[model samples]
Target: MSPSQPEVVAARPLTGPRESQDQEGAIPPATTRPEQRAQARDIVRLFQCRLCSFPLRDPVTLPCGRSICKQCLPESHLRLHISYPAVPERLQGFQCPFADCGREHAVGDCGLDVVLSKTTELVKDNLARGKAEAARIKMSTRIAVRDEWEIAGIPSLRSPSPTSEILTGGRLVAAWSMAENGQLDFDAEVVYHGMDGESDDGNFAEFEQEALHQVQEVARTEMDCQICYALFFDPLTTPCGHTFCRSCLHRILDHSLYCPICRRKLAMNPLLNRIACPANERLDLIIETFWKEELHARQGILEAEEIGRHESLDVPLFVCTLSFPMVPTFLHIFEPRYRLMIRRAVEGNRMFGMVLPKRAHFSSDREFHELGTLLRIVNVQYYPDGRSLIETMGVSRFRVVEHGMLDGYTIGKTDRIDDISLEEEEALEAREVTPATSPQSEFTTSEHGSPDLATQTQAPLALENQEDIARIPTKQLLEYALDFVARMRANSVPWLTQRMLELYGECPDDPTIFPWWLASMLPVRELEKYKLLETSSVRERLKICCRWIMEWEQSRW
Candidate 1:
């Protein structure tokens, strides 16, 4: 070496007892390859709890759209003595711990971020595998170099010649090469010879592909809804840190107000609708980002099911009593089949057809009357024994075109019945009115002078007056029905109680709806009241109501 050049020292490999001492001595600080460390840091940044700075455990997404670990939540923000299956109460203006997100949050508004949670597990597994692989590769390199020297007949304590090359399988395993800086550098490569002649790099690549496939499979399974056992179409997270499909949750709520997984009571809210609950936007975004094709396929399945439901006219039937449009119907559902029907109705559309059961000894293809009303469920309260009290409002009238049995309950295909518009009725009446020159008017005027003739003619004249009464304007008819309802209420009629008023509301001012309201409270045979559903003309319905009221008054007298 020239005096002006820097002296280079050759690195020595440890061996025998010295190597064992090096391994047993003070442990070196844990280290990872640059790329592995970077990957680990990225995962920590993404999924670490903001409060604890550790991998998330039971991740909860707050109302502000940020996620954190549930265990890291401030003690002051949690309700004391909240046991298992019962979610913590609202945080009551709890402030977020994140520096960039100091927004207020309520614990009630938070739910487990199922997709994020699963992703965290995947990332964590990747990190752990990376660390293990790096350590294994490092240890294998040391062992491979020692074995190569031993196979070459080199003593453990002697340094090999700089020019000497150790070979395995005719490939250089350990060697020294000249660097551009006029120094010799030691280079060692470890290769695990396999029966298939595959290089370590190729084996590692295969391992990596298999690991990736496994991770994807796990992710797919994690994204599935527990109830349906399929990929989640519209996922909803409950307050108890459980996730389910929105439709699945609706079905669950219809039968019981508790969560399917944890059995926690689900508080009724506007977000929970008859058909579906509000979807988890965060989890949905995660699913869409990673599994776009699968999610689309799942959504298509749901759409096809919905189409089939509508095309088949698959409506559940409650064969109990007579119901009319714009009227409230209360039901005490106790039978197993009807309870199942209510659950299915609530899960699908919250609607079912209400019909009067066919009279005993009457032979018919259907179990109920053909004319019926469609009732939309407004609220449902479930009991411990699976019984429920459901409040429903009549939506429209329908006539059963076809009917069948389903799960021991009646199902119907029906055509909706709507009343003729007042304009149409008025046009028909105009065309039917008699001209002033008609013989009927002349006969009435000519008989007015004879008392004996008038006496005999009074009955026919009264009938004519009654017919004229039915022809009154809709506004006047509405006024007459309102007056009758008000008078009956003033008299404190048994059926017209305060509770009934609260349920059905005060008599509606609309003429088309007024008749149903009056008839619902009337004490008459349901079969007799079924006439209202059959009538299409509002004027005729009012006439029927007027006659019913007359008979009721006559019976009272």
Candidate 2:
């Protein structure tokens, strides 16, 4: 029948005994038997179709763990085909009927639930037998009361009429007299003999216990993660109407962006972090309700794994170019392995390490430099074909202690590297201070009336400049680096473009960060610039920058 035209099973009134009791002017004892029956009927309602409110005909289980009759399943459509032509052409299904569980499902993904079907049949049979037995006992009670009234010489009151009603009222006094003398007590007890059947109660109780056990078993089987072969922990449902543990799905996506069971393409956003992909709330509730202890155990295991991951310092590594702390790095991720790595990083802590590739002649043992910058993902834009452009900012410098390859990408255990504390910097500067000298005095004047950078190193003034730089204050060092950037921009240096300024921002006011910023913008070789990562002293990095600027100016001359 159509869902709107539900076939309701209305409760049948207690006809025989109730009618007889009313005619005999007898007051019946208040019993909870009817209320008990109503409760049992309500429990049976669980087997009814959610759509039609009738006993399930062919139960089908949705990915969200709700069961509905197959006939009640919604119509499938070709919407997925139109939206994503790359996806294989097939009829996609509809959302679950339950309001709390609206996870979309494909027609092919939902199938008949054999266990629920058998359990439904058992419930129907038990309900039918109970109703029939109650009816039989009720009918027998009415017949026995009529026979006892006839034996007591009371006029037959089977038919309701004016005469019968009057005679029944008159016979009520005689009936009570016979009842007090115990003439009607034996028949009354015999009429309710069937109600005390121990065998029937025992059989029904057994059936109920068995049905409950079957339902629990079905729940356990359904809640298990196919990949892990255990109760689902943090379950997530895909658009294809398949549910899997969140971790299992993550591992699956690393290999292929398709549903493992249906082989259907999963629509996923690489930029969407793990928090955005929420677990199946309804399915999680069901799993918890059925397997609370198992779920807790699974959670403990996951927590332990998380703690171990942190203790090991394991992190994904992106080995491509040199990156410095506080600098922004833009990457075009197209390779499959790197794509997977980016997804995992975004989903996880949104952090990964970026290091420059080691030259083939430099090191055959390792492919990348040990010193690298830890990058935190800032933003990500994805293409329809799985390509993505990600923006990340370097958080800190790290040294790879140990490294390995995973799914074609690099992974490493790293320790963070920080510049010396302010106190340490002050002490070093104080110990290394020398007499001050003007920077202009370091260069010799050429015929063009400008400083000749090439001859500056050979002049006596060059040693004075070096001595003054060693004792220079942090503020003065920053000023020198800023002045060098200004000169380069004024000279219209090829690498120092407006875009570069906008990208890295004008040289920072902090002396320690200034060196890394200038070093990143400079056209110096990566290996030469790699020195910045090795040094802990800010003054030392500034010295390296000064040497680079001098070499560039000398080269121009």
Candidate 3:
């Protein structure tokens, strides 16, 4: 009641502890106090709805025994499309909202928590009573202070809201809410002075601003992509705990299939790799919470870069051999850069260019022949040491228009090549002529149409834009090519022949393309194969292959 003294209210005493014991057959025979049990129950009640952070309502327990608000569960749109049996399978991938308890839960794993529901009702009762008591006390204090301030010529200040007041002090003293003689009291000591300093509202705004600044700083630093040295755009965290922007990780993986920061091998099959590392859902959530603007900006940059990458679509090149259309090529990839190249190729359209080396060089950007074959992957077998043996077949030939290096591998802008065909008149005229004294024409014909014999309707095809072309019968061309392959002395020739026989069945129908298959199976030198590959016309390619086989036959002497 002193004019110069601040108001004080008597403080409430805490509840006395009552000893308790667990059930007789309990596993641990644990001892607890009533106060301690109550405190534990209160702690559980304070846990907010995992999705919305409001007090949990209509509690639903997960398989992990943690409860969340039923309304907080994701919408069951999946049930609309999924079969009843498949519902469990589909929900098996649903992530628990609780941090560090990120265990997946199936729809079958969730049910109403009856015990929690009862506990929630008790908690609601307690909260209601506490709020009502606090409001009554606050109203009484306001009336008493208003009258006292008017009598003492002191200005009356409005009290802060229940939430703010509790956040500042009531919450700190909440443990002292025990009742004595059916009454709760609060005690305080204060120094009062005329209001001449910064208001509490201004101080609160400054504190909020500082907290936001701190959060933004931490988010930017933690979510930065190590490869690009920028905020993560479409961030992906490797199994090794390192995160990077999806595009940056791809660029790094283009050179090495390892974590760019730790250099640890990423656990992935080179033949079945992905665009980036596995996603970190927890980190993604954190980034979205604190750095949404940065994430949006990063997405914009990534979208622009994606458009740029496609503007001039570049095909990765393997400077190894002359792959022809429809011919299977098996590659043993061991080099780090090539392993990355194969990984990316397998992940993407499963296509790449196979070219002969211009010279005996591996790392040089311009070391590959201008003209190459585009190959489509068929299967891949991985080894323990991150190496891979991939099986692919040539799709079409291509001429490298613009070549460059990305990371360490060769990439080229290419134009696909197609075999040239003659005009209808020229084709008919050329078909009338047959070669004399050619090895292909020497096959003896039989009534049963044996593999060695030429068909009666078969004829040579005249290629467009070529002169002085030697003509060979289509059936004879296949016979000669198979014959040339059978004469090869290499150990791999038999297997190659078997594969070829299995695929084309001893001979391919298209005479223009048959020579390339023959060329692929032959034990000819790389240079010879490259020369044969460069030939545009079927007749010219056949003549060159025939002369090479003849020379090889003579050299065998």
Among all candidates shown, the one with the greatest lDDT: 2
Candidate 3, clashing residue pairs?
A: 9-186, 9-187
lDDT to native, each model = 0.56, 0.58, 0.49
For residues 1-557, what per-residue lDDT tens digits would candidate 3 score against the true structure?
12222222112222654323232211121122222323321332233344544445776655443556788775442221111112222323356677766644445435554433543455445544543544443311110111223234342433321111121112211322221111121122111111112224244234324433443453344455667777665555443335566567655643455777668654222111232113444345446655678778878887897777656748999887678876678889999999999899889989899888776355545777788988888899999999999998776677888887787988988865544422211232245334442322343334432322233243343232223224443334344555656555245545365656676445554555577777766667777777765765555566676666566666742
Tens-digit lDDT track of model 2 for 1-557: 11111111112213233222342433233232333222222333445555665566777766555667789888664322111111222134576677876655556446565545665565455444433553443311110122344335463643222121110101112222233233443223111111222234444344334444444565565667778887778876554556677778765654455778878765333111334345654455445544678889999998998778767647899999998876788899999999999999989989899988875664547888899998889999999999999998877787998888899999999876655533234445545543343333244556744344356442222323445565544435555667778878998988899898888888676664688888778888999999999997777888778777667766852
True-structure Cα RMSD, model 2 = 25.1
lDDT of 2: 0.58
Task: Please list the residue runs of candidate 3 whose C-alpha ends up more than 4 Å from where it truly belongs after superposition.
Answer: 1-313, 360-365, 422-475, 485-510
Off by over 4 Å in 1: 1-313, 360-364, 429-465
* Model 2 TM-score, 2 decimals: 0.41
- Models ranked on TM-score: 2, 1, 3
For model 3, where is the 10-residue window of minimal lDDT?
161-170
- 368, model 2: CA deviation in Å? 0.8
